[model samples]
Target: MSSCNSAPKRVGNKVKCNLSFFDTIRKRPIGPSGYQIGYDDLVALKLYSNFYHYEIDKLEHDSHYGGIFNLEFSLDGKLLVAACEGKQVLLFDAANQKQINSVDSAHQNCVNCVRFLNDKHFATCSDDTSIKIWDIRKLKSCLRTLHGHSNWVKNIEWSEKDNVMVTSAFDGSIYAWNLKSHSENNMLYDKVFLMNGLMRMKLTEDGSKMVIATTNGYMIIIHDLNLATLATDLRSFKPSLYRLMQISDQCYPVATIYNYLFSPTRKRNRIEFIDDFPNEAEVISSLQIHPHGWSVVSRNINGEENEEWTSVHDIQSRDPSDYENSFMYIEEDIPDEPEPEEPPNQRPTDLWLGYISLDEYSNHNRDPSQVSQNIWENNFQLPAMGILNSGLIGVNASYNAYFQQHPEQRNKVITNLPRMTHFIKEKNVGKGYIKELCFSSDGRIICSPFNRGVRLLAFNNQCQELSMCVPDNPQQLKTIVEMNDYHKDIVVSCKFSPTHYQLVSGCLGSEIKWYQPVV
Candidate 1:
């Protein structure tokens, strides 16, 4: 089912690319006979995006699909599972692109995430507000259905080290299920992580740190999941830190991860970017943590500019020792509107400084949607994709002290960290949402969803090119190669093979394109 084509029928005299992928070894990008590059993996990947240009018109395509929400490759890379807007979960043999099994209407609503616990076992979560564990061996029925969220369950992360299942959703809550207990009542712990617009959470491969992407346009990071590694850098918002993501006066979100450092309390720690980073625009639509956990790749759209950028950021892990603990709920960032002067005896309604017990404020944000709406409106017409760190959740001393320490930054919103190292990428993705993105196992490339197709963004071939002091110039780093001509509809999900140099992607056109390099 594969053939070696020297060039696609409609080859361009000048292929669109920034860096020469194979120039060192070959005068021409592709040898007349086909990929002759000594590196098999590099040739396979290069050909998937570059040589396919010669066969642009001949690219094989499948029948229409309702819409694909996400795709996942099993750790062994022998199997692929797709979660679809059609309410169907599909399993396929990775090598041949053949349907192995499928569960139609797997969820009452759109299935958002499909994760492989192992080659034979997998998990799925949906807008139906429930997470189901399935035995791929029996696709007909799920092994267990865990329900605890009050809204759409956007994502699920498994911590193999602690045998715990973590789920986060639009409900602004994170819940952990102890699989170790092996009981129907396995839901271990639950807590609201944000006031609203919480959409996705990702665990680094080691599960040491977790990053969250929210609709309010922020990235939240939690460090030392199992507390396996302790970070001693405890100066949260210490003035010595370099600033980056500043957009006028508003803060952007970087991350908010609940640390297990405090044991029973699960003390929360976060970075509030009152503006700092590689770039601006945080209405982040998609996020993926790198396998090694040092960084994360996130996609954001500037609704105001009608543009999107995929950014890579270092995970700035801060130690929780600055103050034992204090968690606070922040619904409003600094608004451009002049602050309303408060009566001598009146508490600021928008600025709830008096630690009115967390529960009393909890009622103020019962409806997630309203909280987000009121937050943005009260702050100002937030016009783009971004995140700023807010307050943590614990005691008042630490909370008030956090504010007092940075009196000058009091008006600036708090979110994720500043000092976003690595990369910030922009693409001419005209219209539609880029809902999902992922990093290959080696972390050398990013499989990012483009408008109607997909983009393959290369990082350092070795992935350790962190020597630059300033962010790389945005003039096309020659890293992102588009495999876009193939898909006719907005591509929603894609994944790289963990076991092979293969790729599988699904689109709103209901077509799934599997790219396997033919030597």
Candidate 2:
């Protein structure tokens, strides 16, 4: 194991830091009955608090034990729900984060995605080749199951303002559902079979355009999407003209802009795109556009190959001639730096882990048109911190060498990793991979799925372990909390409330865990 001393230290308020157990004191917070607060809860409180004056209640669980692929919190952050592989839909009270109710067979098979249509209603899609709508008040059954797709439903995106939702399936088909009229519109793009299959899709801020990512690494851009126009006459939904661009030969392109699209490469420390520019690659992963559509954040995938590094990139457009010269073109106001060198004996502090984008939960209530005009102002300028060492190692040697051919000055423009406030590790929980991590609306707490449970870390600028006590013996520090009651199998997906401190998570065994922070 690498020595803890090798880890970087925080430099004032800019970087959050964590301390070793032996380095702490014994004056942790005491609860109302004068009892020492639970260790796990105490840790959560500290992680979420600025003064460490608070305490978390205890570990809570739900009835199911399957691996969850996704979870979402309501807009108010009071309710948490999830879709499980076991074909179950689970619910919980966001205030206490405990299981309140669930539907054992929300679908005939695995539920892949869950989305909220509004405060009282939500929708889910599953491997059973259908989508079901449910109400939070009645958890025992679904309100309706919408059928059409002949394959697993991979994802669902809804526009509450338009009262329409889009569902994409494994069969390369896209279906539009109208909440008001209860109608469906099928998308039949020209040359659809040439693009392997539909992998994912993104709607423009006002729902006027959709950037569809296909399995063949091409982006199909469709415009003029109107349910009213389409429902009245089916042909109205068929766009007469569509724009297509080749992004990758076969790799899945994850994010896109009006003029640019982002795709992944097997290379270490970089993501290339299919845009015309001085540079076409940046170091990022799981790139997601902000709800407002002007900015994007990296979901920051960590692994041994890339040193567990990830960063957020701001998209700004600039005059091409400003960066042009006889020999090459370059972005202005950005400095060049050497790529980070992987430590010979370094190991990822967190391994087999997954990530969820802040874009997924941030600014859900705000009008997409008003997010921040300055969001795209910087125009792809790397964050000031530069590339960070996530302590994970794994690199594609061939791809790395090929991309390395670009001048160091071009490859040098990249962002750094976000500061890690604290690390929460559970001993008894098996080392099953974590699929997603989410932060509460206020940015106070973050939660990620665990092997058989979910782990939460309350976060703020302060490091409170200085006064908290560590167990007298090493073995005594088994875990901060054991959330195994939620699922008997591995937990996979999770989401946070857009406005509250509540959380929702799911597992592979098809169970859901709803957790709330109790002070």
Best by TM-score: 1
Model 1 lDDT, full chain set: 0.56
What is the per-residue lDDT of model 1 for residues 1-519, given as tens digits with 9 covering 90 to 100?
544343333223222333355453564555555544334444434444452321212212334236777899888888888887667888788767777777887987778888877667788998676898999777779988787676667787878765667788755566677654554565445452444445567777776677777554456566555422222232222211112223233232222112222222344333332123345565666788777676777777654645667777767454545323332333334445344465545422222211122233333333323321111232322223222223332223544564576443433332333535445456644344446787776666677776665666654432222332224442222343556656677777888888776777777776677765432
Lowest lDDT block of 10, candidate 1: 235-244
lDDT (C-alpha, whole model) for all candidates: 0.56, 0.43
Question: Considering every candidate listed, which one attains the maximal lDDT?
Answer: 1
TM-score of each: 0.66, 0.47
Q: How many residue pairs clash in each candidate?
A: 51, 28
